[model samples]
Target chain A: MQQKQVLLLTKSIKEKAIKEFYSKERPTTLCIADLGCSSAELNTLGVVAELIETIENARQDLGNGSQEYQVYLNDLPGNDFNTIFRSIASFEDSLKKQIGSNNFGHCFVNGVPGSFYGRLFPTNHLHFVHSSYSLMWLSQVPIGIEDNKENIYIASTSPPNVTEAYYDQFEKDFTMFLSCRSKEVVPGGIMVLTILGRTSTEKYSKESSYEWDLLATVLNDMVLEGFIEEEKLHTFNIPQYTPSAEEIRFIMEKEGSFILSQVDVSEISWEANEHYYKNDLPKTAFTHYDFVKCMRSVAEPLLVNHFGESIIEELFKRYLETVQVAMTKEKNVFINVTVSLTRKG
Target chain B: MQQKQVLLLTKSIKEKAIKEFYSKERPTTLCIADLGCSSAELNTLGVVAELIETIENARQDLGNGSQEYQVYLNDLPGNDFNTIFRSIASFEDSLKKQIGSNNFGHCFVNGVPGSFYGRLFPTNHLHFVHSSYSLMWLSQVPIGIEDNKENIYIASTSPPNVTEAYYDQFEKDFTMFLSCRSKEVVPGGIMVLTILGRTSTEKYSKESSYEWDLLATVLNDMVLEGFIEEEKLHTFNIPQYTPSAEEIRFIMEKEGSFILSQVDVSEISWEANEHYYKNDLPKTAFTHYDFVKCMRSVAEPLLVNHFGESIIEELFKRYLETVQVAMTKEKNVFINVTVSLTRKG
Candidate 1:
């Protein structure tokens, strides 16, 4: 899903956001910031290369020979900045080589350790901003959700207040994210945000409803086996949300800092089908294991922090078995939403 | 010398540089960058705290209650940033407590891993810049001085090219430093640089002459004792220089980006003299040991890299005995020069 979202950026967003910003501003130093830039350097550096290429093309069009880039890779303090910093010297070396050093735009990389919920950069300091698979993470789990028992996210079995509390937190967090970026980004700046979200047509929809059900079911299975405490399961809630496209549009309207230039919504299948495999492949395919790995990469840290590390292997084992049974009869896909915005003057 | 330079900042540099920048710009988020912010969290954070207080006090003087601080702590990419980053959370917590959090100026700290010899920030993005004991480090060892044999620096017994090579490197490095900073700092921005320098009156001064000679002396002693190679001792030259106040002033004039507003020169004792000794300490004093430890902190890594790790224990052991003998007959003090600069329009 993220790969497709990145592809969307290369086709549409690269042309609109960066090209427009460059033609309008012609800033000698084009400053870009990547919010929630994970420890994985490949994804973050790929986006940077794309943005730089867009700027390079724009400069070539205008007969501009000179420009520099200052990229701020931001994340929570615990993110592995050392790994990224270690990779930068070589990253810059290759970037210079790929686009001849003499003609290429000089690039500077920095790590800004903080949350994007509040202001990160100084006023009118940024030319472009981006976030990928990061905005779904709320500042925290929603308040007044104590009765959201035995479930880590909103579900069909959840009470009405549970959904309301989660949405309330999302509205506040997404609004704050927009308002903060408005101040940091220059007028006519651009921001491209890719969030996992449902289509606006799904009215009264609980996004990730069945996904949470399987996770909760796995925890209950463990509870029956005397592995995890029932009380712990009752109190735990994922500090995340999957909003509808309409909910995101509403936040932008309330914040009133950015014009929604474009939004694209598409569903991505969770399981890889047999179409890609060759005839010689193994027969007892663990198609469901792929889903477990994907979900575990996102949720393992939170679970380990909340429930302790001892239950992880058993928890995932039970989750894999449950997902295998569910995969045959049910459809599972993530709603990938990409939105591009222009900072209002 | 560095400790005194930091003290000078608390008394004079803070009031002149930060206060002037704050009063002139009235920026809501005052940006400050510390070039060569070493891994010592105490020293870097101390400077940051002083900068914030200066801005906080300036804001208070005008009855302004809202302000934010964004501090960029810069160092070479190889620096031990993990230790400093690990300490920031508690540091911020204490800072917020020290100044009441309700209306105190919010502070943001970021680590920029790079060399300061080139442009680090965006054009006109920095408000104030400062570096302590950092500018004395030349970008590299000057070329064509392989004949300055057996000695690590310019010495009385050395050829003329050795002195000329060291001075040439210092001038080029310093001028480049100024020009690069001029592009990044805003017009009327302030910079306070504390360099370990000579008093400028001496026509043939060899700053750190005896110090490096003593180190060379120790290395040669090891070489004679069959512990190190003679070829290695002759090939190594320190990638550092201590310029006189006059030389520094000349570079600023040549760079022509900053106006020299104030200059103060002071000498700091290299050894712990009688004045600092307590009543109950051991009588078998390692007074020369103080200088060895200080120099080791700065040069140990370079030594270990060039000569291998095996020689360090024995080399320093000989260095202490040589320094102890030299201390009885010589005067050793570091000449500290502090210059305040304002970026010219």
Candidate 2:
């Protein structure tokens, strides 16, 4: 998923971050941060590497490649930072190959272990901020949505009240996030966010519901088989939302800290990467295994904490088969919303 | 050990960092770092907690209390950052108790995973730096000391060339460390370093040799009993050194970036923390179990990496017994050397 998003960052880095140095005194160090940077081995640094590469290219064009970098990689405390830290030596070695050592000033990478919803840095510190597939997540599951029974997220089966609860929560949380970041970023610092959202013009996205509805179906099967308690299933909801472009724009205006510079809506195929699948199943038009693995990474910890560890294998297996059926019935794709913003003094 | 050194930090913080803000426009944030902050459960944050507490007190004295904090907790990548991050919420809670919520601004703690031997940050960024019981560790074991066979560290029986090699490595590494930090730390900013060292008038303290000799005796016994290889024991040297205050001063003077403000020598009894002993080994004169456990955490990773996995349980068990016998024969204590420095422009 992040692989596709990597290309989107180059434009932000080249235009907003790199080009600014041409007109001003080039700082000895460039500080940028990636919020909600979930670690998955080497793939976690892909965005950071792309950010540096773009800056280096632009630096060469401007005839100076001597600025240092202070890169902050942020996520929740439960993230696997060890894997990311262990691979950094190799990452630096590879980076030195692309930009020669004489031209490359030191790139000091640090991991910020915390939530992005709150104040993650001191005021007016960061030069640029980037969050990919992160901002749609609420600080916690929405209130008044406990009755969103049998469904974990906004779904066709969910009541209209449940949808309302989710929208209100998104509006409130996104506003808080903007308010916090407004203080952390310098007056002219820019931010580019790539969110897993509903990119359509409609208020309710039918295309996005298939993913969550399929997950609910898997849990329902386990409940019928006496593998899970009905009460536990009723209370479990993912602290996530997929917001529309208008919803985001509305919240930013109400927050009144940043000017929205760019808003892009795009569709990404479900079978984005064939190699991401683990099993050697015969390749099919619908990539159920790859999608299942992706969802498992996001959902496993929550499920194990609530439903116990006994049902994970069976749950994801059921989810894969259910998704297989749903994809066969209709074509589906993830909606990505990429927005760029400039801090307003 | 860090508990005792926490008092030494208040003076540095109050005089150097806090007093400066009185004359200048109060920046909304304060940037500081704790380098080589080895995680020991909740104890890891003791120094950091003290740093913030002192600053808050000084801020109140100056009649200003609103300042955000960016605290960088740095250590080698192998350090247990997970434990420290897990306990941060409680640390923050306790901090709130001390300072109260109205005056207690946000403190963003970040983990910097890398070696301090090279450049860790960009030029003139950090306002303050603190390292405790960390710089004594050389980046790697000195070359040419493989001939210092059967002994893990500086010992009476090692060849003179072996001692020279250790000294040379320390000088080179210490100078490199000072040079790199000179760039990272802002001019006129201060540093406080508390190191485990030999504080006696004699260059080589007889007090320190009991530790390595006991470990050497245990390994020799293992080799004789055919439980360990003789060749492997010869190559495994702990990449550690205990320098006198004179050696530290000489190197700092040669490095020429920091002005040494104070060098205080103190002695810590072997049984500094009785509860640190994991087992109930009845009351005794020496804290053998506590000392053994401390050595195990530091040596286990290096030992396991070189000597394989089979000997660890046996090695520590034999090590404890050896330390038990040595302690009864003589009383011993750890020498601490705490120094304060100001970065020069």
Candidate 3:
């Protein structure tokens, strides 16, 4: 289980949001949900534990020890939500015993396993929302990215300004995101989103980003050597988005239903090294590492197509060399920015 | 000054010997001479040129009409007096004309210059030896490479290795190339040596190859912030050795006695295209615009001092971006190699 290093920059902004929620928009039963939650024992338990601590701390500080809260754990159907629900169940049981079940109530956690872009919770049923390292992924690639495919999941570099198709999809996904939140989140609910982004003014070219370039290079090597046909290349897409800070701010402010409270930016060093690949992360973030590991599955098909049976051995060698070189040379850093906003009551 | 292409790759092994002599041996001559001869341009003029044309037209009948040959223009100094003077000169230059009041019948002519690393002429006083692009510079680098004023020329990757130092020095200078040839040639003889070399090689470091790193990143802004200093760089060696082919084989076969042979090597390309700039090459040797203009000069100084002026403005900007992203990129072919020889005897 890899434990993600909490982004201190985003954490600071989140702290302010939590404060506003507890002070101004207090509810008898606060409904908090972290969307795109993957089922890792620690993520389910750790975040719940943190939420409990925050609520308790606020209650004790304000001399109002009678605040009730309900936390929700949600993710896509493919995510490990079952484990999350079980972990949440155990957590609630443990806390009910220690803190008087009646005085300090436990959260009624649920895993709404579906794409968060569309309607998930009933209208105006949510209070606080938090999403970390997610939301940037478009629901599906915009149309026309591939020669004949129906939907595009990844984008490739083409002639100048030819990514209009991907941008359109991103626009749809963002609009859906805003509308989805607008329906479920209470008028005064606060939402905090921390995702990847870029600062350069250059338009989004597939090869413009290091992550995209590395992936494309690897894939192209496979395609050129006949490991995988060109058709297979179009099947996959990085569901991530790299909105400039300005772009994100514009989207939220223009939506008009949400009032921007704060925006914080920082870099996340995620290179597989002593710090990242030691396999010492908390159980909560292990799912993220597992997702990264799944990428090897994608590379495997390409390798097998090119090198035949020798693909496995050759892949390991290439992977080792790549990891070594990447660890030493210009290690990867995930640029992160968090925006916190309150819905208009 | 004719432009050199890929012709040197086809030169015969015999001619290779003489050119080495004219460039490295520094022999003296009493008759004809070749100055600063280059392998690539050997066939651009003289006998080789005729040989190429003959080969090209071999399908038709051989040309008729023959004339006696007197002199052969070989190299600047020590050259192959045996072959250049005895055979190629007569066989190739079949046309001749009478030209003296004294009625001296000058059979095939011979002269080689530059550095006569081998013997050039006979024991007694004799005729001419020519050299072009052979011997006008140091044969090797100075003894203080490790002790250069800035300590920039450390032999090998670490401490200096004298053997490697010699190889390095040989690659750097072209003037100090006459000692042995000077002793072999007789008095009252002509010696022409054409050499190529630099003023110094101690200024650049290995990091120069990673230029894109320094130019396209924050390094540029850092320079603007007054972080880097400025300095000068100079090269004093020519990694090539041109010893008029004749001089070498002559020294090997005939202990000491040999005569002058006409020597000739082109020198025009040295100063051509002194001011041209292009982002991409046009499939030609002259396409290495950056190498001749900016790269060679800046490579050393920018790398050696860690604070040279190369960090200013665009250089730093480009360097940084290149470092952060471009340095990791790979290319298939990265180096160019060219060397040729000619027999002058």
Candidate 4:
């Protein structure tokens, strides 16, 4: 439901933060890949824009005409690489000219298309890694939270406590993340990770998603108005794996290599476009309350049951109203994102 | 001039910071004092509050309340000791009622009045020491930086740089501070220092001071309008010592034996109280920018020689108007403060 907003927020963070890592006369070869990058047409420019700025700044720092970089764009198979490539081609010439053709060259571009959940690159190959708005979506919903009838995970509930099963899954995933990066990045490489986090452990269960407060309000409103049955609501949960700061710190301590350099958390409002729809009432209600599409995965069985035959039409219809509601509300939901850990030698 | 502002800022910081070193359960037959404690109204209470919180949280770790403390309250001769004595009287009854009377019965309190820079108490008599907001003022300004006629140090523009002389004097004073504490505080004791600092070395120059800016602007305006000499304006400088964060770190490192646990730098707003005169100005200008006073320390001598007393007053009247004009246009200033380090154990 917050796909567009999430993308925009991530992009802005990327653009703003890249400057800090780039300096003149010392153009750093930044090798960044967005993990779990989904197939969404929107917000692609934001990420590209951020990378362009970073590369250009690095070239400028290299001075006169002496800088070069090998750019690697990585994402899952579902992401629209064709569109990304086409977009990069359009700006490549001007960038080369501005950076001085002799001193700089086209971002020697290549795509590494695969799941970031496992190994994708050679050992000690990257100098910098950046990922945004993606970690919360677990590779799979935790098996412990799964229900037999629907074969779906119903997130957390009334009392705030992370189901031990969910926490165990997150710990495993985080360890996997460390191992993957530890293999790919050399010692002293820099990483910028902005992920969803929880302030309290107890709050995690009752409000299951990393952004439970925000999504819960939307769901409760839907139930009160009868758009989504409270029983059906029990079948869904935000696809999330949020760890508290303390838990994350504890994991880092156990991992014992990465040093935390900076931690920043802020509330951001995402932008979305609202539009007209034909079916009016049912479509509008569906658009406003269907958190399921964002929550669904290709592997999750609930997607098949919920969408059945007219999935595309229904998903499109519901998205418009959600945007309208979010716009009318004068603000959108928020997530707590923390950036921590510096690569260590 | 900034006494009240410093007082309030220091107070708020104290309430939030951990009081691990100061506690009632810390057995000390020796009487400890926070001379120039400003108001030791909190001398023992601060310790007791920390002890209670710590003991309650880790009763097993502490075992029992067998440790007793004797706290002394001391300040400059004219300080408000009645309040300190009264607060002690009230806390005594409360302490006995809260913790078993016998557990805290050994505690004693007394007040001493004198300059901390001199022999305020007998030598080798104290077990712990704590002082704040009193270190910056020298027992007397160095014999230099003063004009023979005025007797007040016109240190504003004495040296072009932040001045090795200023740093030399600070080192001497700080060493005195440590030596004084070392004498009274037993071999195995802890001392915590929280002081103001600047993140950059740029704020110490005459050209940077707002008063200088105003005086220059007024001089320029007067020059353009054919009222004052440009050559005369060149003599003015600002008197201020805002050491950079690195400089402070260096000073502590030089003093040696201090382990830094946490250093928190917060940009404080002088407008914490809106009704105060300074609050009427931008917190930055008032808190960080008082370049006029800084300018006075340097410019007055030059003005006295060039413009003479009567014309100088007239020019200052116009300059004051220009300052108000500048301040009304823009207000907050930024200062960096670090609270870090532990005395070498």
- Please list the residue runs of candidate 3 whose C-alpha ends up more than 4 Å from where it truly belongs after superposition: A1-3, A7-9, A93-102, A147-157, A205-208, A234-236, A272-320, B1-345
Deviation (Å) of B139 in candidate 1:
1.6
RMSD per candidate (Å) reads: 3.6, 3.2, 33.1, 28.6
* lDDT pick, better of 1 and 4: 1
Q: What tens-digit string does per-residue lDDT give for candidate 1 at A100-162?
A: 537875687888888899877877879899888889899999999999887778876678898
Candidate order by decreasing TM-score:
2, 1, 3, 4
Tens digit of per-residue lDDT, candidate 2, span B1-345: 434534453345334544453234355667788888877735557667777777777677778857788888888887778778877878888888977747678988998999989888878877778877888899889999878889888888888788788888989998998899998887777787877888664435666556777888898899999988899888988788788889999999999999988787777666664554545454454546767787887788888899889999999998987777766766677777778788887
Candidate number with greatest TM-score? 2
DockQ-wise, the better of 2 and 3 is: 2
At residue B125, give the lDDT of candidate 2: 77
After best superposition, candidate 4 residue A298: deviation in angstroms?
10
Candidate 3 lDDT, B1-345, residue by residue in tens = 212322332233223433343234332221232333433343323533332232223212233222112233434322222233233334434422212112222232222322334333223222223343334233444464443221233322324453355444443332122333343333433343333222223322232212322332333344346554212222322222223333333332343233334333322232233344343743232333333334334343434445444444545345434432432343211111112222224
* Model 1 ranges with Cα > 4 A deviation: A1-11, A97-105, A200-212, A271-294, A317-331, B1-5, B8-10, B24-29, B62-65, B89-106, B200-207, B271-278, B282-293, B313-331
CAPRI-style quality class for the chain A–B interface of candidate 4? incorrect
The lDDT for every candidate, in the order shown, is 0.79, 0.78, 0.46, 0.50
Question: What docking grade applies to model 2?
Answer: medium
**Residue by residue across B1-345, what tens digits does model 4's lDDT show?**
233454345443343332444443243343455656555335435654443433333433555444434455555555554455456546756766666534442444544545565444333445455554445545543434422121112224435322554556666776666665654554345454545445546535332233344565666676666666555444333333345556656666776645555555555442332342453554434422343443453366656766666566666667656665665666534343544344454
**CA error at residue A198 for candidate 4, angstroms:** 4.3
lDDT of 2 by residue, A1-345 (tens): 534544454355435643563335356677889888877735557666777777777777778858788899888988878777887888888888876647688888998888887888888878778888888788888899878889888877688888888888888889888999998888877788877888666545776666777888889888999989999999999888898878888889889999987787777767664454545654455456776787788889989999989999989888888888777776688887778888887
Error of model 1, residue A185, in angstroms: 2.5
- The top-ranked prediction according to DockQ is 2
**Model 3, residue B109: what's the lDDT?**
28
